[model samples]
Target: MPIPSRAALVEHLVRTRIAGDVATPRDNNLSHYRKLANGDRHYWLGLELGDRWTDEQDVLAVMAERCGVSDDPEHRAGQDTIDPELTVAALDRLAARLRKAAAGKERVLFATGHPGGLLDAHRRTADALRAAGCEIVAIPGGLIADEGMVFQVGGVAVLERGATLWHTHSPVPMAAILDGLARDGSPLPDLVVADHGWAGCAAQRGFDTVGYADSNDPALFIGEAEGTLQVTVPLDDHVFDPRFYEPMTDYLLDAAGLPV
Candidate 1:
């Protein structure tokens, strides 16, 4: 695959609703923001918060800065937006992190709550990192309970030489994975590349973590703000065709000096 030019990637981002005119509803963003501010654990994913985020307005401000959502609280029932430029900028940062990991042959793990949308990108990234001689650690898998549901198990999807896990929404899956690794006395991952609770939990546990987020998901942004998360690419995470992300994958791999 040919890496996309910056201009072309930006255009694709807008055309696919990854950024610019995003498909995430404003009300959904607002609801999540409110829940985050109010200290909902499910909304928090895994990060602990200080009093700095107790107010909804404060959360909204951070969301505006990090996720490119609207700053205005009154505009509540329209389309939520993510800046394409911010998305591209964060992707560059992610590439830089990948480059550093590749140089060191660091142990890394990749996972996603958004298996239906972002798995392809994670899979491609894992392949490239493995080719660069990095150790892609696959944590053990199990049936983990969901944080928000009373009787549901968020089953883990381990893939790519144990480099990637997918379809997990709760932090329990990650916690269980970490526990299993510790019990077996395996080295912890040097870096974790993931999204949603997987990213938040890893970052909170002091791993070098980077991931993608939609405007509606404020937990990763909060984690980034608190200095736990290393990078977050803001966009509509699951609204578009999965193939639309191939150019981005190519661009990021190229930027990391990996084979595209």
Candidate 2:
């Protein structure tokens, strides 16, 4: 069975319910609202974009149209993209528009297709929302590079230096902590540290595979034989809170018990 797209689902919901005057394309410019038959205020997420290749807006518009809310413009109603760069541009534009619409709205949440990638994009989006005076909560990414390293190394003779190297050029895009086992030409990992995406982890898990979140948790440091390890690396809780970074020269110096 084929699953219906978001637009289809929203269109069905709108058509079955909602009875009110919908703003026309021009009136939908901004600050458009509809009073439902039950006196509920329903704001449209994509009211201005009558017909556009926006997944979120198209879904919201379809909902309005189905509920007799009016989409007389016959806007483009589906996702169509041949160019990856263009798609990313479109996404940025859509995010800007949605953030603008979120102004003065209570509890507006922006949903994205690529959440992990969205973490990378949060700086701009979060700033826009803050400027708009909207209450926004951008959840932290599930994992980071260093926390992932501790999880990968487990407890393989904690080097006094606490330095690790990542093999970024390998066929697989993963960070490799050079433990004694890796240097000793051992074929099997003490435990597979699946810090990459689900597919990436699945492919690398010829040995026991642990998910990224599972490995990063500080409570599960059972040891290499147990296929479990965890560590709490201090993270800066500024704008991008909980984002882990490699210990700086000063941090390393401090960790080495040397006065800066």
Candidate 3:
């Protein structure tokens, strides 16, 4: 498929519900935001917060600025919003980073918690980067055991030819991967493209990272703000059909000077 022009892609972003008016309910976003403010580990997604974020209102302000969600504390319910412009702007930055990584032949890792929603895009990104001569690293063989949760084993970090990993959210998987790498004295990734806990944890580990986030997932935004994360594209993650992201993938690849 031919890549859409910027204007056309932006139009598709709103028309297909990839951006602009989002489907993430305000209440749901608020619920997560409140959890983040309260320092819930699940919502924090492995990010350590500073004292300034102790208040829910302060978190709201940050979300409002970064994710385009409503800042009104009075908003008790209804739909949430993500500015399409913000998504585009962030994608521009993401693409620039990808271009730099490709030029430098950086070893890259890509993972996603929202595998159902974003795997296609990430896969395409991986393919393009590989075609550009960048090495897509895979960190296989890890187990994640969250407290009070069932232990998940055989969660190997398989890197597809297109550069995507199986569904992953916990930093434990990456931590295990890094540990194995250190044990074998293998090189670590120069960049990580991921979302949710994967992105947060990698950033916390001081890896150059960029990823997507919904209005509710404030950890990546906070990480970006704190300089731990490189860039975060804010949008309604998991709200649209997977194919709706093709144009976006094309845009990013083209922006990176990779073949679309």
Candidate 4:
């Protein structure tokens, strides 16, 4: 895979509509921030946030700095953005962690709540890390959580129910993974690469966790702020085409010095 230049990645992000005036509008973004501030556990994404992020303005500030959203509370209805530079910068941080995992030959678990959009990216990263001597943590079968069965497809953990892969924001699946590993005397992951509840729960439990988040999801960013999460990259979690993530993933792997 060719490594995309910084300029090229930025262009891809804006042109592909993954960032820069994205699909998630400002009003929806503010709504989520408000709910998160009001102590909605659903917005907590599986972490026990307590009162660390109860201020709507505080959450908006983090999103603006880390996610490139507008900080103005008055700007409630127009377009929002995921700054391409911040996205690339956060990807650099994520790559640093993966590079260390590879160098240490560490046990790394990769999971995704965003199967439709991020599955390929996770798979590509996992495959690269495995090739570089990291152990891709196994997703144990028969594991169920959050009313959905936990399963692995193409080496990435995801939630499934009713014979369909379900999109989830619950951390129960990660808990099940850890519990299952303990029961079998298997080693816990040295690092967890995931998003949604998977990343939140792992980080809460003190694991080295890194993952991605969209503009509306502020828990991972809060976790980073609170010193629990390693790093969380910001992007639109879902683009209409899964293939849209290829360039970003390629850039990430390249930055991590891992061969595809």
Q: Residue 80 error for model 4, in Å?
A: 0.8
Which candidate, 2 or 3, would have the higher TM-score against the true structure? 3
Model 2 ranges with Cα > 4 A deviation: 1-82, 110-117, 138-260
Residues 34-99 of candidate 4: C-alpha lDDT, one tens digit per residue: 999999998998788898788899999989988999888889898989999999999999989989
Query: Best to worst by lDDT, what's the order?
Result: 4, 1, 3, 2
**Cα lDDT for residue 63, model 3?**
84
Candidate 3 has which clashing residue pairs, if any?
A: none
Top candidate by TM-score = 4
lDDT of 4 at 51: 88
TM-score of 3: 0.89
TM-score for each of the candidates: 0.90, 0.20, 0.89, 0.98
The per-residue C-alpha lDDT of model 3 at residue 146 equals 38
Q: Residue 144's C-alpha lDDT in candidate 2?
A: 36
Model 3, runs deviating above 4 Å = 142-168
Number of the candidate with higher lDDT, 3 or 4: 4
lDDT values of the candidates? Answer: 0.81, 0.25, 0.78, 0.91
